[model samples]
Target: MDLLINHFWELTITGLAIGAVYALVALGYTMVYGVLRLINFAHSEVFMWGSFAAVWALMAVGAGKASGLGLAGYLVIGFVAAMTVSALIAMLLERVAYRPLRKRNSPPLIALISAIGASFALSELMGLRDKPLGWFNLENLRDYLGRPRENLPLPLQIQTKAVFPVFNYDVTNIDLIVLLSAIVMMVILDQFIRRSRLGRGIRAVAMDPEAAALMGINRDRVIRLTFLIGGIMAGAAAMMYLLKIGVTRYNAGFILGVKAFTAAVLGGIGNIRGALLGGFVLGVAENYGSALFGSQWKDVVAFLLLVVILLFRPTGLLGESLGKARA
Candidate 1:
């Protein structure tokens, strides 16, 4: 309690920074659930892939020990690489995994199982990426694989300098960038859904698939678009995550992905704003709980918070459906 009170501002700012990543990842889960009524477990792998892509892209460009304009340029390359890779992988999941099942009119349970399978497959593919290179006698090029199951740190070295002070706690550039970037992305998505023509198609399908089809909204196209949007969000989350954490692994997304899902459920699974709120709430709660107890209890604190919240309001904080969101 004393620790939390003393460092409350610091915890809050840093927590919000971490929460920004969670919120961006949660957007993927929430948006897909809003449209398809199915959880895409493989979405986590999409995030992991993006992180790897970002790292690989930076490494390819020899981005290291950069500062000022050079650092900014490297970041742009990372974001572009991560977003592009995540988007393609997301679209591919829809085409190769979920689309076939949807065509067959598979039960939701079956689709879920497929999602889980796809998640494992993607994770393993990254884990074993060096195996193919080894088989082809490309030992010199396999350094990037870095022992598969181990941690892969970013090549760039980012220094954290405090930008301002809040209640005696300094807010660093990373914190501001993360929080602002997430808010901007969320606002763009919310506006896009509210005003765009394709957005209406998405809302129509979510509201009633049959009616949407009857009204000439292409159901297949809308579904693809949903996955694409989710993927893009996940990709952005990946870049932010790498910026904050500076390290990743083949299975890095597993735990974070679960937390993001909890955030989505906490905020109202289908509500875009709900995801944003839930993520910040969860992040703050985790920090406070850790301060009260210990660092090891952070995960426990987060899930416990979710359970307690759900017990009282199962519909979530802003449990409005995407289809029902106001323009």
Candidate 2:
């Protein structure tokens, strides 16, 4: 308890940064689940690729220094690249893995299977890029994918220089950047879903597909848009993760994706605001639990919280359907 009280603000700032990542990733899961009622298990790859996209962007421009206008411009470049690539990949997944299944009116199980298969294929493809294509001298793959156990290097490192103090904790530039950027995204997304025309279409479809289709709302387009939005959010998260942790791998997204999925379920699967709420709460709780127990127990504490929450509030904290949500 003393450890917690003394380092409370430090832990809190850390949790919020991590929770922002989870929340961004969770938005992808929750939005898709909201409209399709099917979890896009392959969404992890979407996030992973986004992370790579940012790294690639920075690498292409050879970003190094962490401060000044040049670095800031490069950061924007990285984010834009990440979002573009992530959105494209997500759209690709929808077209290849999901579109055919949906057209065949396949069972939900089939879609789930397809998602898992796509995920594995993508992961292996990244992991083996050097293995399979190395014979062709196609640019050393070690620069990006490397061996399965090895992590890809991120050249740009955001120096965690303190800009302000939060009670006893010194808040850094990276902390504010991540938290504020995430909040901006969430606010925009919530407003879009609640007030925009296409967002209304999304809500309609989520509430009733047949009804939405009958009303001349193109279900296919809406579905694609949902995936795109989710992908974009995941891209934002990918950027933050790379900037904060400065390391990534082919399968990096798998665990984070699962945790984000749990955040979605914990907050009320189809609700946007619920995702935000669940992510922060879970992050804070996990940090506190780690303080109470030990650092190694943090992951255990997070998942355990999900189990406990589901046991008590089966529908989750907010429990509102996206269709009916005011966002």
Candidate 3:
């Protein structure tokens, strides 16, 4: 108890930082589910790819010795690479995996299977990218991936500095960046959806595809935009993750994706604001649970809470449909 009390703010801030990433990814899930009524399990890979893009961009830009404002410039390049790559892949996934199904009017199970297959295929490609390159004896790109599970060393190391007081603990640069950036991203999305014409079309389609089309809203365009927006957020999360954690692996997004998905469901799958609420709540819960149990059991605690939440509040704490989101 004394230990928990002593480190209260530490745990909370850590949870919030991690949770912000989860929220960014969770927004992808929530937005897709809202528009399509289907879970894009492969969306996790979108995040995984974003991380790689950022790291690869770092290598390409050679940002090793950058400091002060130069570090910030390099960070922007990495972020842009992540977002562009993620958005492209997400759009491709929608075109190949989901669009075909939608055109054929396939069952939801079929789409789910397609998503799973795409997820596995993307992950394996990231893992065994070298094998294919070796087939052509192309050694350059092979070296880029390094290894399947090895940590991809970060180039620009952004030092953490205490900036503000939060309770009895000092909030560091990392915490401030993660939290504020996440909040800003979510707010922009919320405003876009609530106030913009394109956003209105998205909501209309989420409400009813047939009627939306009859009302002159292009369903295809809306769906693509949804995927693009979600992908961009995932990319942002990837850059933020790299900044905060300072390393990544081929499959790093897998576990984090699961946590983010839980966050989506915990907040009400289709509700935008709910994703934010869920992510923070889960993060704090995981931290507190880890303090009580052990660090090794954090995953257990996260999933257990998900199960408990579902059992009690099936629609989530802030229950609302995407069409009627209380954002």
lDDT of each: 0.89, 0.88, 0.88
Instruction: List model 3 lDDT by residue over 1-327, tens digit each.
Output: 675789999999989889999999999999999999999999999998999899999987777866568877887898899999999999999999999999999999999999999998888788776687777878777667777668886777776788999889999887787788788888999999998999988888888889999999989999999999999999999988887888888788788889999999999998888998999999988998899788998889988998898889999868857888842
- Candidate 2 lDDT, 1-327, residue by residue in tens: 899999999999989888999999999999999999899999999999898888888888888876878778987998899899899999999999999999999999999999999999887776665765567776665565555556877778777789899998999888788898899999999999988999999999988899999999999999999999999999999998887888888889899988899889989999999999888887787888899899899988998988888989998988957887663
Better of 2 and 3 by TM-score: 2
Q: Per-prediction RMSD in angstroms? A: 1.1, 1.5, 1.5
Residue 104 error, candidate 1, Å? 0.7
Q: Quote the lDDT for 37 in model 3.
A: 92
TM-score, per-candidate, Cα-based: 0.97, 0.96, 0.95
TM-score (C-alpha) between model 1 and the true structure? 0.97
TM-score of 2: 0.96
Badly placed stretches (over 4 Å) of model 3 are: 140-142
Instruction: After superposing candidate 2 on the true structure, give the runs of residues whose Cα lies further than 4 Å from its correct spot.
Output: 140-149
Query: Which residue pairs does candidate 1 place in steric collision?
Result: none
Question: What is the per-residue lDDT of model 1 for residues 1-327, given as tens digits with 9 covering 90 to 100?
Answer: 888888999998888888888988988888889889999999999999999999999999998887789988998899889989999999999999999999999999999999999999999998888788868898988787788888898898878888889977989887787788788888998889888999888888888889999999999999999999989889989989998999999999999899899999999887888988898898888888889899999999999989988988998888757787555
Which 10-residue span in candidate 3 carries the lowest summed lDDT?
Answer: 318-327
lDDT score at residue 203, model 3, on the 0-100 scale: 86
Alpha carbon deviation, residue 222, candidate 2 (Å): 0.2
lDDT of 1: 0.89
